[model samples]
Target: MSRLAYGGDYNPEQWPEEVWHEDVALMREAGVTMVSVGVFSWARLETAPGVHDFGWLDRLLDLLHAGGIRVALATPTVAPPAWFYAAHPEALPVTKEGVRYGFGSRGAICHSSAAYRQAAAGITEQLARRYGKHPAVALWHVHNEYGVPVNACYCEASGEEFRSWLRARYQTLDALNTAWGTAFWGQHYGDWAHIDAPRVTPTVGNPAQQLDYARFTDETLRGNFIAERDILHRLAPGVPVTTNFMTALSQCDSMDYWAWGREVDLVAQDHYLITDGRRTHVNLAMAADLTRSVAGGAPWLVLEHSTSGVNWQPRNPAKRPGEMARNSLGHVARGSEGAMFFQWRQSRQGAEKFHSAMLPHAGTANRVWREVVALGADIGALAGIAGSRTMADAAMVWDWQSWWAQNLEWRPTEDHDARERADSFYETLYDRHLTVDFAHPEADLSAYPLVVVPALYLATEAVGQNLRAYVEGGGTLVVSYFSGIVDEHDTVHPGAYPGALRDVLGLTVEEWSPLLRGERVRIEAADGSVLPADVWTEFVVPNVPRGAEPVWTYADGRAAAGPAITRHQLGRGAAWYISTRLAPEALDTVLAAAAADAGISPRDDLPRDVEVVRRTGEHGSYLFAINHTATEAKVPLGAAGTELLTGERAAGVLAVPPGAVRVVRAD
Candidate 1:
């Protein structure tokens, strides 16, 4: 069985029957082996209520099977038939502003709506029963990207559901009140009726209330996913089910993917390049790494990414020649089992008419189409790379709940974005050619010698306890400022600013000074080199436990006399605290010190534009060397082996052209 599942979302129902023949021929020519169908075809599948017209889908599947392609049949639950909302208006999702969204857009139904759940489950059951034993069906794509448009439903039903969820989480109203700190400002709730899902409030609503709302919404969506997934599992026993995740680019508070990842059979991602005209290969790599981690260090899938440009962004810039190939191969280099796209053919009419596809508007003559064919063939040749996992020596901590809590109201500064902070640290490690795996805050930290946790603003006692044990167990922990300051409910921990971490760091932060826009403070390292600091700074008073020491301090600021960076040794390992946001150069300096302490030597001698990552399997190890820059460069192969892409004999030095990828099994 070839594990490289190439091809993409194929919507043959969108075109006439004659076009389907041409699509099949092109699919084979492009070396496509799989096609995802019926993702947004609820109207075609179910015309009115339960009256399903799977006639079109059945023909589509039969034709695809005849063409020797597998199907990842999707339940048309993303966009319900227009008649569904008309028959049941309660299915509509209300936004935080209390406005009910219309049915024209996808994901407009509330996850908390029982009617929507029943309808979704009914359709999924129908699909599974019909295609469960079909020869063409290989996988089940449960629903399209969940929570893309409206993640939260601030309606009366959601409020009732929120109360129910609270009851389940904290049995009694007294327990709920205590957990939410409702006693503040005479807001103590005597009954569960007082609770709502944090709608349009006059001022910053209770932080605990808002936090619970986020949790409730995520669980609600997960419940909906499980409902559909269960139907598929029961009807289609052996078929693996998955849902596409928006990954690092997702803005929805609902759907904690770490929790959702555990439920899915395979972790899949839908990543589109940043359309702001910025280079995004590194961002793509990071998302793939996180998805791989969520999959328990196994190979996953790239369910959907634009073949060229996407329509949603403010300006949809087309990918340059070979850029798409580079992007897809990058994901595969990390741990993607396959490389797929948003669609097989371009849409003639729809909101996403401008979104690029495998067969573009220019037809077979276009450069995008040519590149797509080439990429498909290239991906097919690397079938042996399947089942191989990218081995990483370092891990980065990721918490979706903390992402929501860190961006709430009434913070010391309004500029604390946890994702940006984490990405910065990940980029530093990538530049050093160190592979990084994203681990949950509570995950086993013993696998990696170094762990970098950034801006974990909302931390629990258990999280702190876990990191303390990890460091004491001989692992290096690098935690940033504004971390471990708040408990799970968004309540500030008493005593020191960095609450539980103060003990592990052997320091206590007395006060915090948030920097204004354009304001900068200089931090001096032991080497007398100064680095600019911004956004935030904590005035630290280190207790300096017997094994702890100071690393850096503010050269001049309101907290100029305080320590800026402190390190403490616990058992055999050590923990370092960065008290402020250091400039890029300064951050490198700080991370360099930690890297050195962890005995991780930076692999910096390679060409600056080339990226090297290794994946090991039972067959041995394969090295993926990618040239991200535009110019050609000669890279030293270090060992001689056969290049998997071109089947060329690669010796001591390999000539890598711009936007090229070489997968070699070296000696």
Candidate 2:
């Protein structure tokens, strides 16, 4: 009813026909109505170059279609077979050290290799020609998980390409040298021929050039993704095609990935958590809400959630009991159309052999299966609620491209960490039970009344203009440290730390110092209440704007001291500035007070120890009041609340147990 699609990845490629049949029954029992097939079938598709095999796949699709299951077809180019690798040796990506990969894992291919492009386009054309009209095909999944460039490919194609990339970036060696400060390193290159990707930092050279190269490399890989996506678009015109994305990934920024949105139908992201508990859970909720917002509030798929512990990380801890269901339901409540497990079944071999699955090694009777079945049923019952409920009047902003620029900084100090700052900022905001949207720094700013930009280390001139306009147009803006210091190339704008923002902020930063990883600096607020800076510390000299008020003071004992935090009027809007990371108490004290300053308030009364978020849709708003604590709690409400998940109703305050959730519908 709500355009809810059920089902997730199913790899029949791994099992016998008999086992496949058994899975169908089990899938139906779990309320699954669709399957994702062909995630790793390049080997099956082309046994040799130009050869195509649809025998096993055709049969599998026919069987699933007969059984009334839809398919989210996969391109399955994770890793090409050894024959293709041997046939086109240039296809292998050369690492930064000049070593080529021999292939063993997924995401091993050189995305830009001529061989990869040729083979990928051919496979896509064939798949589209064969299955584009099939009722069984629902969507197309591009290469899995995308990639990370841990190893640099120093091969010839990449080497030649790097030169071209530099040429496009600087155009002239003089400009390149000036931007890179090449004179400082004596490593000045006479021409493009003298430039090489920074390795070992062999001599005094421009850190900016090297960093830009890293960025160029990042963009190059992103180009490959676009190329591959274009192939899928041509092959499958009507079908929605998407590759799974990692949110806030340091190496591969998903914002750059969004540049190819014309080829993408919907946004799908993976959510994994650390073991510290509620922090991880709340973080995932914010991410899901943000992902949906990026797709213009459409329910984005939770591409591949772990059924249990992830095997890839250095330390893999299995999720605690009830954690999986709680997490899954959390996504649904926040506008996720569907939930999918990375693996429905357990792997018997390879690196992921021990990763958790819905059906454990013990088969169908295990608790995991029971949990899966229970969640499946609950989700089925709430089918009409999926993609139905939406957020209400509150406005919160999160930016993506700005996030990339923040993390790309190769800081001399430890301050280049954007994810850490972003996560902490998110946590402090979410803890207050406020619903926030992750806005791309470059996106339109006029829609929302309140915008938050954290660790804005990178801000393009255009981005600065957008922020100024938003504020001038009466939109409230909240910004944090290391902001507006650099451009897209990670080069400083040369004047102020917040260069483009100086005029709007009405202040100039004289000097700032980096604080220790967890050290705190105390700052007193306007009312004499002190706040702590726990992330990065900066001293601010406020040329205080006329309508702006200094809210927080510097914890750093300095001769010339004033408030490190301030709020002021810029046009019809208000601008709030936070110089550094503040402790939870201080951060909340400021943000909550800031919301009050902007005349913004939560749409509904809140619960004690429960963070409630409401998403407004065309019909009405969906309210999610979640219990963050372990004890039973009651959330305050003025009107009646209907539980969309259980069809239960609550009058007055809604009572919920520890770590439990209630999705309610209220106008």
Error of 1 at 217 (Å): 0.6
Candidate 2 segments whose C-alpha is farther than 4 A from its true place: 1-3, 148-152, 166-190, 203-205, 248-255, 260-262, 276-278, 386-389, 392-412, 516-520, 544-549, 555-560, 602-609, 618-620, 637-641
Worst 10 residues of 2 by lDDT: 248-257
The 0-to-1 C-alpha lDDT of every candidate, in the order given, reads 0.85, 0.70
In the range 557-611, model 2's lDDT, one tens digit per residue, is 4412665887768898888888777766677777786677566774345544576
- Tell me the lDDT of model 1 at 392: 91
Across 502-606, the per-residue lDDT of candidate 1 in tens digits comes to 777778889889999888898887888788889888878877437457788889889986788888888889999998887556788888989988989877667
How many pairs in model 1 have backbone atoms within 3 A of each other, for residues 3 or more apart or on separate chains, i.e. clashes?
A: 0
Clashes of each: 0, 18
Top candidate on TM-score is: 1
